[model samples]
Target chain A: GIQVEQSPPDLILQEGANSTLRCNFSDSVNNLQWFHQNPWGQLINLFYIPSGTKQNGRLSATTVATERYSLLYISSSQTTDSGVYFCAVPGGAGANSKLTFGKGITLSVRP
Target chain B: DVKVTQSSRYLVKRTGEKVFLECVQDMDHENMFWYRQDPGLGLRLIYFSYDVKMKEKGDIPEGYSVSREKKERFSLILESASTNQTSMYLCASRVMGGGFPEAFFGQGTRLTVV
Candidate 1:
């Protein structure tokens, strides 16, 4: 099984600040995804980047598959971004590969 | 848009009581999964189904069971609920593909066992 590790288990940022969250995987992965669990406990899909870079509004993500690492960037952070950010990847190969998630980074954006 | 709907937002149950959490997807995805999220443990997979009438056990499936009678619906069953089983349960659905596809999650069902 592949292990996913997220850095800075807890983070706090001021409104309009920028921050980066990282995720490192122990083994090669065919699929990688970023998720945001809001204060209400709803898990929202952020990005599905197995490799390369993607940008969505003020949020961007880059996955260096060769390095077995991924980085999520948030710019001009807002109070609404206060929640848990998670990284997930399929545990193994084949169609039955289930996603294994990291503990998550708890982000607090002060207004 | 992909929509995953959980039957309940919150539930309270007693020990030894049988409980069922229902999930339905509108996108007709082939893969459906059940996961439990704790305070610091993140999301742990409990069970998953790749197709109707097919199922697979996940990392933490000892106290849980699942059913996939129809392509659009998946159910998680707890035979005898216990306090330790109380947590937020999430249901997700993803399309069947060779590469990693995006999974859409439901709002989650918070269950408390007493």
Candidate 2:
């Protein structure tokens, strides 16, 4: 089983601020994904980056598979971005599609 | 976009009662999973089904069981619900392929057992 650890368990940011959230894994992963659980408890899919870098609007993510680490960057954060940011890696295999998730980073964007 | 619809947004059940949480995915994905999220335990997989009529136990499957009779639906059943089983349950579906297959989640169901 792979282990996922997220840094800065709690975070607070003002509007228009930028922040970087980090995730470190213990083993090689075939899949890596970032998720945002909004205040309404809807788990929104942020990014599915197994390797390399990708940017979506003001949010970007980079996964260095070789180093077993990933970083999620939020630029000019808004109040709507306040939620629990989670990074998940591979868990089960063969026919099972599972993800092993970290404890998650709680982001608070103040007005 | 993939849509995973859960049966209930919130449910309250009494102890020793049988509970069923239904999940349906519109994309016809082969892999469907049920996970329980707690305060400190993060998200723990309870069960998953890769194909019709096939199921596999996940990390926390002691008080949970799953059924996948149809390709698009996966149901988690608690034969005899207990107080400790109260938690947030999430359903997800994913495609099976060679590359990076992303898993899509539902809007979670918060269950309270008394």
Candidate 3:
């Protein structure tokens, strides 16, 4: 089983601010995804970056597979971005492709 | 639009009651998963099915069972619910091919066992 850890268990940012959230895995990961759980409990897929970099709107993510780390950057954060950000990695490098999620980072963006 | 729909948004049951959580995906995905989210524990996998009539145990599968009778539907069953089983349950579906296979999740079902 691979362990995924997310930094800054809780974070608060002002509107128009930029922040970076990090995820570190205990082992190599073949599949990794970032999710945001809104206040209403809808888990939204933010990114599916196993490697390289991807940008969606003001949110971007980069995964360095060799280093077993990933980073999510949010630029000019807004109140709608407030939620719990979770990072999940599949078990081992080549397994059943089931995701093991981290404890999640709670984000609150104040406007 | 691709969607995963859960049967209920909230539920309350007494201990020893049998509970069923249903999930349906319209995207025709190859993978369906059931996970329970608890405070400080993140989301713990309870069960997942990659195909109809097939099942696999996840990290925390005790006191839980699953059925995938049809390709579009997956069900999570609790034969006898306990107080500790009260938590938020999420259903997700993903395709087999594609980059990393992003999961589409349903708005979670919050259950409480009295």
Best by TM-score: 1
- List, residue by residue over A47-84, the lDDT tens digit for candidate 3: 98889999999999999999999999999999999999
lDDT per residue (tens digit) for residues B9-94 in model 2: 99999999999999999998998999999987889999988899999899989988889999999999999999999999999999
Alpha carbon deviation, residue B30, candidate 1 (Å): 0.9
Residue range with the least summed lDDT across 10 consecutive positions in model 3 chain A = A90-99
lDDT of 1 by residue, A36-108 (tens): 9988788999999989999999999999998999999999999999999999998878776788899999999
DockQ of every candidate? 0.82, 0.65, 0.60
Cα-lDDT of candidate 2: 0.92
Q: Is candidate 1 or candidate 3 better by DockQ?
A: 1
Cα-based lDDT at residue A49, candidate 1:
96
* B70 Cα displacement, candidate 3 (Å): 0.3
What tens-digit string does per-residue lDDT give for candidate 3 at B47-110?
Answer: 9998899889998999999999999999999999999999999999987653447789999999
Off by over 4 Å in 3: A93-95, B97-100
The per-residue C-alpha lDDT of model 2 at residue B56 equals 84
The segments of candidate 1 whose C-alpha lies over 4 angstroms from its true place after superposition are: none
Residue pairs with clashing backbones, model 2:
none
Which pairs of residues clash in candidate 1, taking residues 3 or more apart in a chain or in different chains? none
Best by lDDT: 1
Per-model RMSD to reference: 0.8, 1.1, 1.5
